[model samples]
Target: MNDQVELVAQAIYEAEHGVCLWEGEPARHKERFREYARNAIELLDEDIGVLLLALQEANAGARLRRSKGSVRRDPN
Candidate 1:
């Protein structure tokens, strides 16, 4: 969980906070970072799902949120 969180933070920083320093065509850079951010979001969501399952198993009464009609909600 810790590793996953750190990885997500690093990716988000690279996508958003690090952009000003990158010397490249703006549109291209934005597209690239968008992809990176999307991937990182997927990773973070998966990691959170794993942790949520662990919590549910350990504490049977614990309940996680649900997505509208889907089965899960993001930890964020």
Candidate 2:
């Protein structure tokens, strides 16, 4: 839910909407879709990287907390 990730999500939604809801011949908008696809690729690699790192850190923290809590039960 970071800003960067949100932007990426918006871009993806717009791309899907534009492609699916075009009113005219699809061939006329090939370049536009191509640009959208390219931008999506960059966003996936750049913006999502932050989210991925955040998730990794969160998972690590959760695991640490679980281990600490479970240790208290080991001797019982």
Candidate 3:
């Protein structure tokens, strides 16, 4: 519904329809899609909390590994 989402949606539509609105190489359009997708994800992160959940899981795994002494030591 916001500007970033709108841009991503339009890029997706163009990709599906094989249409390019920009006056550049075809690869630029693909890059635009990537940029738009990244921007959309960043914007959504504020409301989604996915990053926080991932970090929490990572931290828990690290703690469990530390508690179990599962860390590997380098052999010299």
Candidate 4:
């Protein structure tokens, strides 16, 4: 797959096989895992922010349409 997906998969594999790779330089591995976790969290936060903005825009549009329709139908 793409580079980002590959990197995430490799990190997950390493995490799952921690027991096998823990013999040497466990501290270094732990630090790398922390980096991976931080990157993943940052990506997730960005995606959530985009989704929230889109939802808000959609809600505002729906409200505007309903208000306009009601104003047109008013007898006064």
Candidate 4 wrong stretches, greater than 4 Å: 1-44, 73-76
Q: List model 3 lDDT by residue over 1-76, tens digit each.
A: 3544434545554557675454354666656665766675677777535644554475467569777787677888
Error of 3 at 7 (Å): 31
What TM-scores do the predictions have? 0.31, 0.37, 0.31, 0.36
Local accuracy of candidate 4 as per-residue lDDT tens digits, 20-74: 2433546666567656655664677657455445545754676698788778555
RMSD, every candidate, angstroms: 13.6, 13.3, 12.5, 17.7
User: Which window of 10 residues has the lowest lDDT sum in candidate 2?
Assistant: 1-10
Off by over 4 Å in 3: 1-48, 70-76
Q: Supply candidate 3's per-residue lDDT for 51.
A: 46
Off by over 4 Å in 1: 1-25, 46-76
Estimate every model's Cα lDDT from 0 to 1.
0.49, 0.53, 0.57, 0.54
Error of 4 at 75 (Å): 8.1
lDDT of 1 by residue, 4-44 (tens): 44334434544467542433447665556556655655766
Compared with the true structure, model 3 gives a TM-score of 0.31
Residue 70, model 3: lDDT of 73
When sorted by lDDT, best at the front, the candidate numbers are 3, 4, 2, 1
Name the candidate that leads on lDDT: 3
In model 1, what are the clashing residue pairs, if there are any?
A: none
